[model samples]
Target chain A: MFLIVGIFIIIGLGFNLLGAFSLYRFPDVYTRLHGATKCTTFGTLFTMFAVVAYSLGRLVSTGEARFAVFIIHGAVAALVLLITNATGAHAIARAAHRSGTLPARAVVDRLEEKEEAKGGTPR
Target chain B: MTIYIFLFAAALVGLLAVAVLGRLVAGPTIADRAVALDTMNTLVVGLMMILAAVYDSVVMVDIAIVYAGLSFVGTMFIARFIEGEV
Candidate 1:
C-alpha cells in the first residue's frame, strides 16, 4: 500500500510539472494552447489514474469501504476535469484567433482579412 | 516499491515545471500567457491529487475536483473576454 501511494504521488507530480513546462516552451498562441491542452490532459490522466490505483490497492489490502469511495469520487472528478479542460482549451484557441493572435511562424493570413474579403465567412 | 514510483513521478513533474516556466516568462503574446495559465491550473489539480495520496486523505482529492471545476470556469471567462463576447 505504501508503495502504491508513493507511485501515485510521483506520477501525479510528473504530470503537473510537464503541464507547466508546456506553458513555457510552446512558441505561439495556437501551439501553446495545443501543448497546454494535450500535455496537461495526459498529465492529469496519469495523476488521477495513480490515485485510483493507490486507493484501490488500499481497499484490496484493507477491505475498507472508504477506499472505494475515494476511488469513485476521484475518478469522477478526473472525468469532469478532462471534459472541461478540453473544451475550455478549444474555446480559448478560437477566441485567441478571433482576437488577432496569429501563429508567430505563419506565412499565410487567410484566416485574417482574406476570409472576410471573399465573403466566405462572417467577421 | 511505491516510494520509488513516487520519486520518479515527482522528478518528472519538476522537469516539466522547468520547461513550462521557460514559456511563461518568454511567451510572445497575451494569448500564449493565457494558455500557460490554463495549463498551470490543470497541473495544480494533479498536484493536489498527489498530495492527497501522500497524506492518505480523501480531502485533497475533493479539493482537486473543485479546483478543476473552478479553473474551467476561469478559463472560459478569460476566453470570452479575449473573444470580446463578454
Candidate 2:
C-alpha cells in the first residue's frame, strides 16, 4: 500500500512541476494555457487517485466509516476540480483571443479566418 | 510514515505554486497573468487535498471543493472583463 501511494505521488509531483516550468518556458498565452491546464489537471487527478487509494486501504483495514466519508468527499472535490479547471481554461483562452492576444508565430489562425469570412474584423 | 509522505508532497506542491508566481509577476499581458492565476488556483486545490490527508481532516477537502468553485467564478469574471463584455 505504501509503495502504491508513493508511486502515485511521485508521478503527480513530476507532472505538477512540469506544468509550473511550462508557464516560464512557453512563449505566449495560448501555449502557456495549454501546458498549465492539461498537465496540472492530470497531475491533480493522480494525486486524488492516491488519496482515494489511501483512504480505501484505511477503510478496509480499520473498517471505520469515517474513512469511507473521507473517500467520498475527496472524490467530490476531485470531480469539481476537473470540471472547473477545463471550463476556466476555455474562458481564459477565448478572452485572450478576443482581447487581441494572437498565438505566437502561427501559420494559420482559423478563428481569425472565420471571422474575416463572416465579414467581421478580427479583434 | 504515510503522513510524512503527504506532508512532503504538500510542501513540494507549495513550491511549485511559488514557481508559478514568477510568471504571474512577469507576464507581459493581462491574459498571461490570468493563465498564471488559473494555474495557481489548481495547484492550491491539489495542495489542500494532500494536506487534508496529512492532517486527517475531511473538512480540509470540503474547503478545497469550495475554493475550486469560487476560483472558477473569479476566473470567469476576469475573462469577461478582458473580453470587454462587462
Candidate 3:
C-alpha cells in the first residue's frame, strides 16, 4: 500500500513539473493552456487517488469513521477537478481567442472565418 | 515513511508552482497570466489535500473542497472578464 501511494505521488508530481516546464517553454498561449490544464488536471487526479487509497487503508486498519469521511471528500474534490478544469480551460481559451490573441503558428482559424461569414466584424 | 513522502511531494509541488510563477509574472497577455493563476489554484487544492492527509484532519479536506468550488467560480469570472462579458 505504501509503495503504491508513493508511486502515485511521484507520478502526480512528475506531471505537474512537466506542466510547469511546458508553461515556460510553450510558444503561445494556446499551447501553454494545453499543457498547464491537461497535465495539472491529470496530475491532481493521481494525487487525490493516493490520498483516497491512504485513507481507505487507514479506515481498514483502524476502523475510524473519520477516515471514511476523508476518503469521500477527497474523491469529491478530485471529481470537481476532473469536471471543472476542462470547462475552465475552454472558457479561458475562448476568452483568449475572442479577445484577439491568435495562435502563433496558425494555418487557419475556423472560428474567425465563421465570424467573418456572419458579418460580425469587417476585418 | 508516509510523512516523509508527503513532505517531499509537497516540496516538489511548491517548486512546480514557483516555475509557473515565472509565466504568471512574465506572460505578455492577461489571458496567459489567467491561465497560470488557474493552474496554481488547482495545485494549491492538491497541496491542501496532502496536508489534510498528513495531519489526519477531515476538516482540512472539507476546506479543500470549498476552495476548489470557489476557485472554479473565480476562474470563470476571470475568463468572462477577459472576454468582455463581465
Candidate 4:
C-alpha cells in the first residue's frame, strides 16, 4: 500500500514538472495555456489519487472513520480541479485570441480573420 | 513512509507552481495571466489535500474542499472581469 501511494506521488511530481516546464518553455500565451491545462490536470489527478490511496490504506491499517473523510473530501477536490481547470483554460485562451494575441507560429487564423471579414472586430 | 510521499508531491507541486509563475510573467495578455492564476488555484487545492494526509487531519481536507469551491467562484468572477462584462 505504501509503495503504491509512493508511486502515485512520484507520478504526480512528474506531471507537475511537465506542466511547469511547458509554462517556462512555451513562447506564447496559447502555448502556455496548452501546457498549463494538460500538465496541471494530470499532476493534480495523480496527487489526488495518492491522497485517496493513502487514506484508504490508513483506514485499513488502523480501522478509523476519519479516513473516509479524507477519501470523500479528496475526491471532491479532484473533481473540482477537473471541472474548473479545463474550462478556465479554454476561457483564457479564447479571451487571449479574441483580444489580438496571435500564436507565434501560425499559418491561418480563421477566427480572427473571419471576425474581421464580417466587418467588425473579433469579439 | 506515507509522509515522504506527500512531501514529494508537495515539492513537485511547488515546481509546477514555478512553471505557472513563468507563464504569468511571460503571458502576452491579461487573459493569459488569468489562466495561470486559475491553474495555480487547482494546484494549491491539491497541495492542501496532500497536507491533510501528511498531518492525518480531516480538518485540512475539509478546508481543501471549501477552498476549491471558493476558488471556482473567484475564477469565474475574474473571467467575467476579463470579458469586460463586470
- lDDT, model 4, position A93: 72
Model 3: TM-score for chain B = 0.94
Q: Tens digit of lDDT per residue, candidate 1, span A31-95?
A: 76776788778867877887788778878999989899899888888898889988998888888
TM-score each candidate.
Answer: 0.81, 0.97, 0.96, 0.90
The best candidate by lDDT is 2
Candidate 4 scores a chain A TM-score of 0.93
Give the per-residue Cα lDDT of candidate 4 at B65.
77
Q: List the RMSD of every prediction in angstroms.
A: 3.6, 1.0, 1.1, 2.0
Candidate 1 chain B — worst ten consecutive residues by lDDT sum? B9-18
lDDT by residue (B1-86, candidate 2, tens digit) is 88888889999999999888898898999999999999999999999999888788999999999999999999999999999999
TM-score of chain B of 1: 0.80
User: What's the DockQ for every one of the candidates?
Assistant: 0.56, 0.89, 0.85, 0.67
What tier of docking accuracy does candidate 2 attain? high
Q: Candidate 4: where is the Cα deviation over 4 Å?
A: none
Q: What TM-score does model 2 achieve against the real structure?
A: 0.97
DockQ of 3: 0.85
Whole-structure CA lDDT of model 1: 0.74
The parts of candidate 2 lying over 4 Å away from their true place are none
Model 1 chain A weakest lDDT span, ten residues long = A10-19
* DockQ winner, 1 or 3: 3
